[model samples]
Target: MQQPASTLATLWQIILRLIEKQGLDAEQFSRELGISAEVLRDPTARLPSRLTDRAFAKAEAVLADPAFALRAAECWHPSNLGIIGFAWLSSRTLHTGLKRMERFSRILGSRFSYRCAMEDRGLRFVYNHGRGDWDVGHAMTDFSLSILVDMCRTNIGHRLEPLEVTLRRPEPADTSPWRDYFGCKVRFGADEDSFLLDGETANAPLPTVNVPLANTFDAILTEQLATVFNDDIVSRCKAFLLRELTSGEPSAAALALALCMSQRSLQRRLAALGLTFQGILDETRHELARRYLDDSSKSVTEITFLLGFSEQSAFTRAFRRWSGMSPTGYRGNSAFAH
Candidate 1:
């Protein structure tokens, strides 16, 4: 696989803004992260992902702040994404804009892939990091999702509250910031990182749609995607699960069929990669369970049905196994804590 590089222009702007707000020396921090201060002047230049990651790590360490990502996101503008952002603004609907963004996400950051799938409840915008043992940075996740939400709000011309927000990182001690920013339930320690937009909100026509301009950008993004063909199986499975999850929990055989492969072949491929089909199913369920549980709009019984449990008792037992508490108890605890 080709190594990923981030365009320095956007990153440089983010760094300078953070420095200005926090009263830090831009040159000193650039040197600390092995980034050339002069590189910030080149609009078309790129920085390797390793160097970018180091800079983010140093920012968290020097500032002694866990919410550094959140702060960065608040400053993010659609124009920061360059052409992709322009495409989103020109899109005819929130759905179209999101689809465009998801399609060309690698152009923004090759380390992550974006996928959008429709479910009974709404649309899920998933962010999957590339295969690696590298430490995942919460700040990057926060910044990315926040920028998505901000873009959606701009298009819709109103505050956009997601149905649910999920993070791969464990729940922080204080989730008030995330809750405040998203204006909805936030879940952590999920199988993957994603957020859900209510079906109605997701399907709503955007105020800024420009059919001609959107078509122009679409053509450009399609060409970009063809040049960087990413045939990632894990991302494909997650996208499938996002669609079929509400309908029912898919068995390995069903999933294999959905992926257009024989069950044996699927199992063999997963084994080669040191993974199992059942493990993926379980992890997906665990992640969805957290999201469903956090939504006050859904009752435990409704959640059981949504999760594909045959009965509420069975779901409660599984919930206990996952969280060390009964379904009701877990819900109550979350409510009290928040």
Candidate 2:
């Protein structure tokens, strides 16, 4: 089963920056939204998608501007989007850059995706969510479209306007801002969210394109797709567990709370994926045991504590079952091999 949708924590940076620019309390606002300080500080972390939608809604409300999220997007940084940002920057053309986004859109959020195709007007880019809504109030839709145009400009080394843009957002009272922002035809109350790039603009070779770097990114991103965010809930669980194991005793309920799911819900999702809570716990402990045993300085008792085992005896039994050797024996063998 696919992991639940989450928003990239870095994507929230712009909204938080905009809030601070307005002289509001970013810390208080983040706390109110259930965003932890740790999540905000970690560039690679992710958060519940609703928290992102709520932050955007607050931005719109605070400024009395429905399109405030678009303004917030001006703060977007190349590094904010993570590795895909660099891959997009080094793309051979606007079209290839977009193709990279099309493939790794999940890095933005599990729900976010795009369709890149050719149409009569130009090469089309339509935004779609895994679920129906883009965000609670569709504020994220504007941010996404705004960032799309921004990305095109940065990649091509100019503010090249879209050939045309269509938004599902209802027409706001004023329209000029939309026009000024996109610098192209803007359609409101549209059937879907999309934009187009003319054939010439789409294929124009980019000066920033670096073939070697782009290929390297492609390989790394391919591995990420295979292992990281490709709907593998088990991997997510193990990552959280690895961080939490030595902090204190860990349990399925605690894991569920961290994952934003109920214990029953987590169990159901795991079962759907042909997994169980105990299976994941044991597997995580086994993997960590091997790593800890490889470190000669770490004693068997210390390893037991780190893996959350009740006692050295228990850890020894489990390690023997997993590796056919005691923790001490495994450590000796590893040290000798080195």
Best lDDT goes to which candidate? 2
Decoy 1 TM-score against native: 0.63
How many pairs in model 2 have backbone atoms within 3 A of each other, for residues 3 or more apart or on separate chains, i.e. clashes? 0
lDDT of model number 2: 0.76
Candidate 1 lDDT by residue in tens digits, 208-237: 866556655655554444443335555556
Q: What is the total number of backbone clashes in candidate 1?
A: 0
In terms of TM-score, the best-performing candidate is 2
- List where candidate 2 sits over 4 angstroms from the true fold: 130-137, 230-338
User: Candidate 2 on 1-338: residue-level lDDT in tens?
Assistant: 65777877887777777687767898899888888777666767888776666777676677766666676557788777878889898876788788779967877787778889988767899887544644444677777888888888887888888888888777878988878999998998887788899987887778887755775575566556545574667766776777677775589999889788899999999999889988888887875676565445668888899888778998999888987888888766622211
Which clashing pairs does model 2 show?
none
Q: TM-score for each prediction?
A: 0.63, 0.66
Score candidate 1 by lDDT: 0.70
